[model samples]
Target: MKAYSKLTREELQTLVHELKKEYSRYQSMEMSLDMSRGKPCKEQLDLSMGLMDSLNSDADMCCEDGTDCRNYGVLGGIDEAKVLLSDMMENNPANIIIYGNSSLNVMYDSISRSMTHGVMGNTPWCRLDKVKWLCPVPGYDRHFGITEYFGIEMINVPMTPTGPDMDIVERLVREDESIKGIWCVPKYSNPQGYSYNDETVRRFARLRPAAKDFRIYWDNAYGIHHLYDKNQDYLIEILAECKRAGNPDLVYKFASTSKITFPGSGIAALATSSNNLDDIRNQMKHQTIGYDKVNQLRHVRFFGDIHGMVEHMRKHAEIIRPKFEIVEEIFSKNLGGLGIGGWTKPNGGYFISFETMEGCAKAVVDKCKKAGVKLTGAGATYPYGKDPKDSNIRVAPTYPPIDDLKTAAQLFTLCVKLVSAEKLLAERTGEAPEKAEAQA
Candidate 1:
């Protein structure tokens, strides 16, 4: 029950030996389990089977405005689908533009458009001498990837429990014209599952940026993915908040039903001011005549309204809640008060972010992999796949079944303990050599 940091060398050695034995037993079982990606389990996906049934040969294929669902004319999206997504996104229907399946693809296109042309007729980003973005640390890698692909310099900003450090964000955005945007998962952020508090949201909305074109790329991916019905994290609507702060065109919000219905077949949308939407539509019209209206109709008919969507998400929560609980319980039973590691207990989201000792994350993940248990790689949560402290690890318990998740969680704890002990021992014994010694 003692904290690992407080344990003497002799005690650590004994603890490490016991953990090694347990790890060896797990390895002998040849258990192959994965806690890598935040994907829906079979049962969760099964619940959405009604989506496929919503549209059949017998169903009507017409929108409220009498647009044929099989048509190629609705450039943004069909009217009903836009209404459904607007309510889901918590934005005005007029400001929502429905896209294809992946919100990520929508994000990529936004950056691509800005690079080639410009955002609202500003100079193209590619034509700038230097462009930079503010990346909150322990953030989503894919968001970072998009910026890195554009060769934009990404500066790391620390994330507090409330949100990304806003004092830093405000200063940087105001001081540097090249700092164009920040990638934010404001509600139930990818790994930590923490939503931006009200004050954080307000600060973000009121930011006085040096660049006229600077925007907040708010990806509200898990807005309704709550794990508990009674307990949930709420985020202020950023678009509205920006409007109130006299910065109506300062943000581009994104959402998708990827987790709600089906990932590859769901509807994605961008909610923003009328000005921003108009700018996006100008480029979007050239890209495609329309997105998949049939799929949009299927989603709308299946969910009917935001209330129906919420009820369905409750069903999803019922399936994945226990898996998240299992991960939390394992962490509590194994590492609580030991100080070897710390993890998040999220209200609603697909991941649990774990932080090992400053330098032990890579070893912990590698140890798990060696024992036939797969985990999200070390440094995966940060930009350029580099966690400066090399401490954060994202645990995704949704993809695997309960039994497999249990095994994976157990193996994960063992790896955490083993690696932490080894790290502590090395630090105690001064075994780590200096960089000069390594070069020699």
Candidate 2:
């Protein structure tokens, strides 16, 4: 396949014509396929059905510390749960606070707590004239959504395979007193699946942000989601590194069994310094008597220990690893050397970051939707739903069945070619494709 940019105008026109025909055939199928979200399919979810039986009427329902699972007293969490999640989070049990099912909920509340009461007795963010957040591009959209909801101005930091551009991140946080925080998915990151290298993590720990209350919102959502046993990505433990750097309160690290077990019904947790935990606990005491202890106990009993949890993730990798491979294969076959686009082949994580030629992502997405396939919106991976180059689309392959995903992936590539060819043809002829055709 020729690079679309190198093709003569006639070559592009012919390719576009054939691609439109292929697309039309797909449209005629009347399919209602979705690749919009990174959700586990039924087969993957069934792997954890043992969780349902982890607790039963015959069960003792008491944790290792003799706390009744039915009780409301453990405001932070049961001790056993902290140990299990601490192992998963790679931090001390003392630093862990077990939340309910959603890590996103925990993150939202963290921001809200800062807004109403402020972090560790600083002035409330609401009282400040402006609060800014640094968002790494080709990053998680929900992270952006959280900051935007709080009315914090978000600045874009470009992402490399190693991680976000550290030079830009350090400079912005150092000089801007208004910069309150940065959202990080350091390990097996959301869209790109690129883990932060050692230097990046070290620099994050050593950052000298202007705001005393500045924090790194480190959401290690896919920390254990490895696609291969031998070839896994390792992330340096952020909390420990921060503590060693004498910046004990510099990060609020979060992780969950959301993807590991059930999507919304699994347990979540936060790991951070004693000072930060104390500050959070003060607000949490008013929030609730406790979260679901029975659920926590069930999870602990189900996974038994961190070793059991790691083995369980292997089962998950078996199911979704092929899905990731299929998408990568199709992308390679359809658009590999065309120079119209490129996509990430992640080792693990839920999404693939696809970069289209400048100004063509939205068009490709629109084309896919019209052909009965839905995708994560173009520019969604960036802050404020805006991709400055108008490139970068997120491909979620886990939700659909393998067959449906194959169809969707094929249509996606077709749309990419169709859109890219049109854009190239328009540039070559000095007009839009349709206008140029009419003139011809």
Candidate 3:
């Protein structure tokens, strides 16, 4: 119950010895648990088994517009699918383009297209001398990975509870012509589960970017993923807000049914201004005849409308809610008021972001791994796998069962305490003057 930082060197040493004994017993169990990826558990995935039965060999293959889904003609998507996904994406069907199963793939291709050809007749990014993107810290690693792969220079913008710092964002974008894009999770953001409030969204829409081709890569991946029905967070629709700000082409929004139905077999979509969609279509036409309309049709038939999708997400919430609570409960019981670490209690989303004492994240993660618990690498939440403070660690509790997650969370807290004690003892004995100065 005592704060680890207040403990004397002798007390810390005694505590570490006691924890080591507890950890030794845990090691004897030889558990092989993984809390690395934000994946749906098998029970949650089972909720979408009905999708397989939605289409069959004997089923009709014609779309709502009478285009044969079995053929390759609908470049954007089938009519019914557009309607379904439009509702899911919170945009007009006319402004939406349904892609294949992966939103990440759509995101990658979008950047690739911009790099090779350019956006709306701008110079191709490949031809430019410098291209940059603003990335929010403690964001989705995959989002950072995509931008990093394109060799785009990424600048870290600090994320507040409401959203990323808007003052810095506004200033940078207005002054820097090479800052072409920003990556945003917008609603129920990855790792932190923080959503952009209306004011933040408005500020985002009103940004005066120096680059004419600037865009916001808005990945609304967890827009509808709420853990509590009553205590839910809302995010303003960026595309609509941009239009209201007289910047209709300032943002591109992405969504997918990957979490709703199947991870790799669901439908993905992009919503943007008509002009941006047109520009994308020009490049899309050359890429292929069309994306998989069959899977789109399957998704449409399975979730008839936005309401149906919402109802289904409630089922996923039921399955993962307990797992999330278990982790929170363990953290609260073990690490509360410890002055060693802190973690977010997200309303919805797949991850809990833990902030360890400065420079202690890698040690905590390494301690966890040595005890047979696999976590997302400590620095993964930042751009280039480098958490400058080495203090943020992402905890994904959704993929494992509740019992397993409880154990994992317990192990995680033990690591936090152990590492914190070591850090505190080192500071107390003047063994780490540089770290002490860094803290000061």
Candidate 4:
């Protein structure tokens, strides 16, 4: 239980030796476990099987407006779908547009459209000399991937418990004309599970950006995803707050049932001001006749309404909350008060972010891989796959079964100890890891 920092060189070396033997035993087991992606476990996926059953040949295909869901005409999604998602997003139905399965796709297309057609008639971002984006550290990697793919220069904004540093955010967007947008996971954020507080949301809503096209990409992906029914984190819904602040078009809010019903197969949506929705529709008419309306109908029939969706998500919560607890329990028991690392105990969201000593994340992940356990690649939580401190490692516990997660987590903590000990031993002896290994 003693902190690694207080350990003598001999003590640390001895610990490393014992950890290596344990690591070797794990390697000998030839285990191939992956804790990399936030995929729902089979049991969790099974909870939504009723969604498939929600549709059948005998079922009525006519939507509320009498539009046959089997046909393609409604570009803005059916009235029923809009109402359902709008209710879930806490926005007006008129402000919502349901898309294909993935919200990430909607996000990518939003950026791509701005690059080519510009936002609400501004000059295309492709015409700009420099395009920059604000990326919160330890954020969703795919969000950064989209901006990075478009050759957008990303500036890292440190994340606190509440949200991104607003003073820096306010100052940067006010002074920097080229800074176009920021990626936010406001409710139960991707890796750390931190939610934005009220003041942070207000400051974000009130910002007067130098760039007319500046926006906050408020991806409320986990709006209703809670591990504890009573201890949930609340996010001040951005679209409404922005409207109240007189900056109705300052943010684009996105949500999906990907985590709720099925990932990549569930309905996605974007909620914004009517002006933004009109602009999108103008261009969207040329994109396609419509997205999968039958799928939209399927979702509507499955959930029946927002209340039904909420009840279904509670089923998901029941199945996965224990998995989150298992990982937290293991991490707390093995690593607590060790001073070698620290990790988040998120209230919701698919991942738990772990911060190892500076320069140790990659090494720990690498060691875990060699022992037949896979973690999310180190530095993945940052833009351009680069972590300035090389410290944050995301632990995805939801995908694996309970027993497998236990083994994987134990291996992960072992890797942490081995790597931390090596770093310390190297510092004290001024020797390379290989040399330190030989000595240990």
Candidate 5:
């Protein structure tokens, strides 16, 4: 149980030998377990089975306003859907536009629009000499991918427990005219479930960017996703805060029921200022007659209201909370005080971010993959898939069942120890860890 660094050469070698034997046994099992993405498990997905039944041939296809959902022409969304998502997104019904299934899709479209047409009559980003984005380190990889796909230069901002370093964010946006936007997950953020504190939210609302088109892409993916009923993280409604700060057009907030109901069929939404919505409509008008109104109506009918959605999420939390707790328990029991690595115990969200010894993360992940377990690639959390420290690994626990998660988590910790011991042994003896271990 001693810190690996404090162990003698012989002791470290012995530990590595034992760990290798255990790892070999795992490999012989030839099991294939994946923890590479934060996806809702079958049990969690099962909770929303009634959604399909919410709409049937026997049900009326007309919305509350008497518009038949079967036809097109409601470019924004049905009124009932707007109200449902508005309550969930914490915006006025008039300000929210419900889109098709995925919030990620909405975000991608937003970025694409900004690039081709521009935000609210601003210069199109494609015409700009340089387009830059501020991305918080250890942030969402898909968010990074979108910016990278558009050839936008991404700058990393360090993340704190409260939020991204506002001192840095404020200075960068104020001085750089080409920095168009920053990606944020604000509540129960991905990888690390750190929520933005009040001061951070205020500073973000008050930011006076050099670029008139600068926008905050607020992806509140887990706004109400909490593991604990009594203890939960609350986020300041960014759209309202922006309006109060006299920068109503500064942020575009997004959300969806992808996790709540069905990942493949849930409704997505964007809540923003009228100016931004108007600009988006100009492009959306040509895009299609409208998004699937039938799907929107289905979501509205299924959830019934915001209260119903809250109750539905409670059911989701019941299924997911234990998976999170078990991972925390396994990590603490195996890796605590080892001085080798550490991990986050998120109260909500689907992931737990682990920070390994610098330069050891990639090796640990590779070891796990070889032993029939898969983890998110090392350095995948950062922009451009490069982690300068090469230290962080995101552990996704939501997809697998409880038993499989337990095994995967234990294997993950075992890899951490095996790699940490190898790293220390290499540093002390100036011999390759494999060579030293063979000599042991």
Candidate 6:
């Protein structure tokens, strides 16, 4: 368990030889396993089968507000769905807008609206000379994808366990007028499952942005995705904090039942201030008459309430927690003292962020792929698919079978060792590759 950084060139070369044998055996197996996406395994997906039964030919179709869910008139959402998602999103029912199946879809539309219109009547971003966005590094890829799709200049803000570097955040936001928004996965964040502490939440609330339209895109996707019953992450509710700080329209919060029940079929919602809701509704009225109220009713009737959804998530934990443990144990057993890398062990959320030696992440991923395994591309966690250090690979363990993940994880560690050793050997000879290996 000695640190690999302390090893002599000869020792490193010997380890590389052994690791290559292991890698070769994996290659011979031709095992095409994938650990690239944070999708629920089959068993986890099966836990919500009752959702299909919740609605049928003879079920009650009218919500409490007298609107028949079969037809369409409730632009915001049905009252029952609003109640259900409001509690889940930790906001007032009046502040919630139950969108269609995908939260990502709603986020995309929000950006699109801002581009054509603008936030709360600021100048349209599309007409502006330059529109910029602050992105938290080692963050969600789709968040970056949204901003990138809109042609917004993205600035990377380093993330700490507490949250993004708030000093720099405050400085840039205070000084820059074009910085219109920032993407945040505030609770049990994607890739690394770190939650922002109370101070970070307060700091976010108190931000003095130069742009009047500046807002925080708080995608609390994993707010209730706890891996343990008793040990869970608690995030200070951003909507309330913004209100308390007199920045009532400073944030927009989103969540869904994707992980709890179904992904593409789940109900997604956004929570924000009453003023913001009014503003969004002005345009939302034109987007659709309403979303799928029948599916929303099915979700509400199936879960019954927030408590029911939480109980269902516990079932998911039972099925997938062992898979998480298996991967973590394998990593610890194989690479505990190797100073060449590090990784995050999160209590909840779907991804484990793995770090390889500087300039070695793409090489390790390429080695694993050649051995018939797939991973999230090395730079996916950062803005524009570029990790400046060429490290930080996101390892997703929830999709594969447990036994398969173990083999994949071991093969992954072997690649790590081989790549690290090669990097270290190159360093010993005062040589480094001018151009790094890019993951295909």
Tell me which residue pairs clash in candidate 5: none
In the range 51-163, model 2's lDDT, one tens digit per residue, is 99999999999887788979778999999999999999998999999989999999999999999999999999999999999999888999999999989999999999999
Which RMSD does model 2 reach against the true structure? 1.1
TM-score for each of the candidates: 0.97, 0.98, 0.97, 0.99, 0.98, 0.97
Q: For model 5, what is the alpha-carbon lDDT of residue 57?
A: 95
lDDT of candidates 1 onward, in order: 0.89, 0.92, 0.89, 0.91, 0.91, 0.89
Per-residue CA lDDT of candidate 6, range 1-440, in tens? 68888888778667767766777788999899998889999998899899999999998898876778999678888888889888888889989999888999988998999999999988989999999999998999999999998899999999999989999999999999999999999888888888999999999999999999998999999988889998888888888998899999999888888888899799899999988999999999988999999999999999899999888889999988899899999999998887878998888999888888889999889999999899999899999999999999999999999879989999999999888877776666555632111110
Deviation of model 4 at 75, angstroms: 0.4
User: Model 1, poorest ten-residue lDDT window?
Assistant: 431-440
Give every collision pair in model 2.
Answer: none
Candidate 2 lDDT for residue 89: 91
Per-residue lDDT tens digits for candidate 4, residues 154-264, read 999999999999999999999999999999999889899999999999999999999999989999999989988889998778888898999999999999999888896
The C-alpha local distance difference test score for the whole of candidate 4 amounts to 0.91
Candidate 1 lDDT, 1-440, residue by residue in tens: 88889988777667777877888898898877877888898888888999989999989999888888897889989889889999988888899999999999999999899889889989999999999999987889889999999999999999877899999999999999998899999988888988899999999999999999898999999999999999999889998899999999999999999999988789999999999999999998888999999999999999999999999999999999998998899999988998888999999989999999898898889888988988888998888898989899999999998888898998888888888887776676667522211221
lDDT score, residue 84, model 2?
96
* Colliding residue pairs in candidate 3: none
lDDT (C-alpha) at residue 53 in model 6: 98
Candidate 4 weakest lDDT stretch, 10 residues:
234-243
lDDT, model 3: 0.89
Residue 377 displacement (Å), model 5: 1.0
